[model samples]
Every structure is written in structure tokens, then in C-alpha cells.
Target chain A: MPTFRVELFEGRTVEQKRQFVEAITKATCESLKVEPGSVDIILVDVKKEDWATGGRLWSDAG
Target chain B: MPTFRVELFEGRTVEQKRQFVEAITKATCESLKVEPGSVDIILVDVKKEDWATGGRLWSDAG
Candidate 1:
């Protein structure tokens, strides 16, 4: 089972997500030789406030 | 330190999440003998349309 947990900024469209998963699935299948059906991808949309970098929240970074 | 990424169908209440994380942290502490504060849990809510199984999206499964 090739399970993927991807965290990115919020605001992506459904079309973007669809294309992303398709590409990810393709890459995983080719690299790991796993069936496309067995790959599981969970996308997490994180608000800027919830994510921090360099000890500062992304929302407050600007 | 134990980190967990849990993915499940969306629609869970905040109270449910609070309780679930508490329970999971407790279990992890006891099983792995790690400190409660050291446990990190990220919950991902998945829509039926975004998840697929057996080469079919969950939304299309029905």
C-alpha cells in the first residue's frame, strides 16, 4: 500500500486536485511498481495560520 | 516522539476530534511510553468525491 499524506496551502480547485492525484499516482506506480488502485493519497489543506516556518506563523509572516 | 496522520471521512464534529486525539495520545503514551506532549496528530478529512478505491471514486461508487 502506497499511502501518501500531502499537506499544502488551502485554495486549490477540484480540478487541480484531480490532476495532482493523477500525476502522483502515476509517479508512484512507475517508481514503486504498485498498482494505481492500491495507492492512497490524502490531501490536507492547511490554513496559513495553522502552519509556521522559522518559528513564525505563515499568516503572520507577511 | 510519536507522530500520527489519520485520514477518515469528513463530517466529524470538533468535540469528536478533541476526544479522539486525547484517546489516541493516551494510548500512544502507554504503548510507546512517550510523553503526552510529544505526540503529534494531524487529522485529514476526506470527501467522498476525493477518495477512490478499487479504481473508482467513492462518490461514484454508489
Candidate 2:
């Protein structure tokens, strides 16, 4: 099973998630040759304070 | 670099997360022979409604 962990900035509607998963499933199937049912995707919503780049948190930046 | 996606049932405290990541990082290093910094782990808190097993959602399970 191919598992995908997607990190987003949060505040996405359910409809957006539905479409996102559908597209992601298709892409994963095409590349990994895995069945739709076998692909597992977990979307993680990360706050700006929780994420950092180059030793600086996203919330700290403009 | 080994990227790990960990799914949990949520409600874990910050100390728990810190310890979890440390242990996971150590285990990964020992097994994969990679540096601690090379192992990237993204912890995903999965809601019962969002998770399913054997075609049944966890939230629906009695």
C-alpha cells in the first residue's frame, strides 16, 4: 500500500478535500501502479507556528 | 532521507510527541543507518471519522 501524507495550511472545505483526494489517488495510481483502494492518504493541517524553514518558523515570517 | 508518515488517533500531548519522535528517530537511525537529521517524520492526527478499516469507518464502529 502506498501511503501519502499531505501537509496543508488548513481551512480547506470538505469539497476541496474530496477533489484533492480524487486527483491524488489518480496520480498515485498512475505512478505507483497501485489500486485506488490500496492507496492511503492522510492530510495533515499544519499551523504556521508549527512549520519552520531555514530555522525560522512560518508564523515568524511576513 | 527516509520520510515517515505516522498516523495517530489524536489527543497526544506535546511531551508525548517529543518522546515519540525521539524514539522513532533513534529506531530509524539504527535500522536504516541514516543520521537523525536525515529521517523526516510527519505525525498525522487522524480522526475516527476519517479513518476506515475493512470498509468500515472507525467512527461508526461500536
Candidate 3:
């Protein structure tokens, strides 16, 4: 089982997520020769304030 | 640096998250000999409708 944990900025619509999962599943199946049902993708919507880079938060970088 | 992505059913409180991060950081530092500040934990709250097992969504499990 290939479980993907994806972290990205929040605000994507449910339709976007649906398309994302479908595409990812397809890509994984092609690249790894795995079944689509074995690919599990968990999307994490991260707030800018909750993520930091080089000791600075994205919200503060603006 | 160690990054952890955890997925669980939604509905945890902020206080619970605070405690969880603290405990996880401590455990990582102790187990992996890593610095507390270098440990990153991302928690994903999953809805039942979005997750499936055995070709059946969790929302329809019952």
C-alpha cells in the first residue's frame, strides 16, 4: 500500500480534491505498477500560520 | 529532521493537539536522538465520507 500524505495551503474545493486523488491514483498505478485501490492519498490543508520556513511563517512572510 | 504525518478521525480539541505535539516531539527526540525543534508533526483530520476501506467508505461502513 502506498499511502500519500500531502500538505498544502488550504482553500481547494472538494471537486479539486476529487480530481487530485483520481489523478494521483492513476499516476501511482502507472509508475509503480500498483493497483488504484491500493493507493491511499490523505490531503492535509495547512494554515500559513501553522507552517514555517527558515524560522519564518508564511503568514508573516507576506 | 523527522517529519510525521498522522491521520485520524476528526474532532480533537486544540488542547489535545497541543499535548499531542509535545508528547510526539519528546518521543522523537528520545527515540531518534533528534532535536525537538527539528521534529515536525502534521495532523490530518479525515472525514468518514472521504476515506474508504474494502471498497466501502467509512461513512457507509455502518
Q: Which lDDT tens digits does candidate 1 get at residues A7-61?
A: 8999987767777777888888898898988988777788999999899999998
True contacts kept of 2: 0.02
lDDT per residue as tens, model 2, B8-44: 9888999999999999999999988989989999987
Give the worst 10-residue stretch by lDDT in candidate 3 chain B: B52-61
Residue-level lDDT tens digits of model 3 in A1-62: 98876788988766666667777777778999988778776667789999999999999996
- Candidate 3 at residue B55, lDDT? 32
User: What DockQ number belongs to candidate 1?
Assistant: 0.30
Cα displacement (angstroms), candidate 1, residue A6, comes to 0.6
Residue B44 displacement (Å), model 3:
5.4
lDDT tens per residue, model 3, B1-62: 99998888888999999999999999999999988889999997897645544333455556
**Candidate 1 — which pairs collide?**
none
Off by over 4 Å in 1: B1-6, B12-44, B49-62
**Residue B20 in model 1: lDDT:** 100
What's candidate 2's DockQ score?
0.12
lDDT of each: 0.82, 0.76, 0.78
